[model samples]
Target: MWPADIEATARAIIADFTARGLKVATAESCTGGLIAAALTEIAGSSSVVDRGFVTYSNEAKIEMLGVEAATLAAHGAVSRETAAEMAKGALARSGADLAIAVTGIAGPSGGSAEKPVGLVHLAAAGRRGKFVHREMRYGDIGRDAVRLATVRTALGLLGEISQEP
Candidate 1:
């Protein structure tokens, strides 16, 4: 039930993280924990994946990841700010060495003039205070495609961070 590219990325993340003796957590919105799912599909991911938070709603993001209501109101859930907050929260709350967060609109609907569908914001944070964020516009790529693309990018972020000394 996982894409090949995503599965490959996840396996690489698991390998890199395990080698580094680091753990990972995920805070997901649009991808709905698909990154976590991909990692867990690996045979030995338990040694690397700490947890996955499927914060699919604004309320869940607030309660689970400490995303502020004001932040959501000001920038909406799909913005980079919210994605950063979600990443920090996951890193803090899950006690993982690194965490990845994703938020987005992926759909045949939910498009606006400003924030259209297939707009995804991603963030990765490390406990040592390193952080990275990205804004991806997959552009009406369909929900499944957007979500899969998101998982790939998230895993890539995790891989990148894992390589850091």
Candidate 2:
């Protein structure tokens, strides 16, 4: 039940990872499990997708992905630090060779002067200390649009890390 571009991206990732004999995992917050869901929606994704963590809360992020409480306290869950930690944690916890994490505020509400609605942070971690991060401010976009954009960005990150030499 995904859009054509997302489905195509997922299919491409599946093929790429399958060819490379690599697996991937996801740690998600505001986008829930949509990143993983997109990957798994492709046929034969089980060969590449190891697991997905739907860590939608601070507690869940700490427990499921081993995000540090102090990091959350200092930087909050939507920060780059938390997203990086979640990616690292997912890589550590799963059998995958690479992991992607996303944390964001996707809403018609929850806007503040600092972190407004549609603000998203994403990170990707790979074996051999490969890591990458991105922050996007979609700016008061509807929740669905923000979430979908985050999923697209996350999938792109996964593809990028997998292709790294």
Q: TM-score of each candidate?
A: 0.96, 0.98
Off by over 4 Å in 1: none
Candidate 2 worst ten-residue window by lDDT: 156-165
Q: Indicate the worst ten consecutive residues by lDDT in candidate 1.
A: 1-10
- Residue-level lDDT tens digits of model 2 in 22-82: 9999999998899989998998999999999999989999999999999999999999999
Checking candidate 2 for backbone clashes, the offending pairs are: none
TM-score of 1: 0.96
Q: Write the per-residue lDDT of candidate 1 for residues 59-94, one digit (tens) a residue.
A: 999999999999999999999999999999998798
Q: What is the lDDT for 16 in model 1? A: 79
At residue 135, what lDDT does model 1 achieve? 96
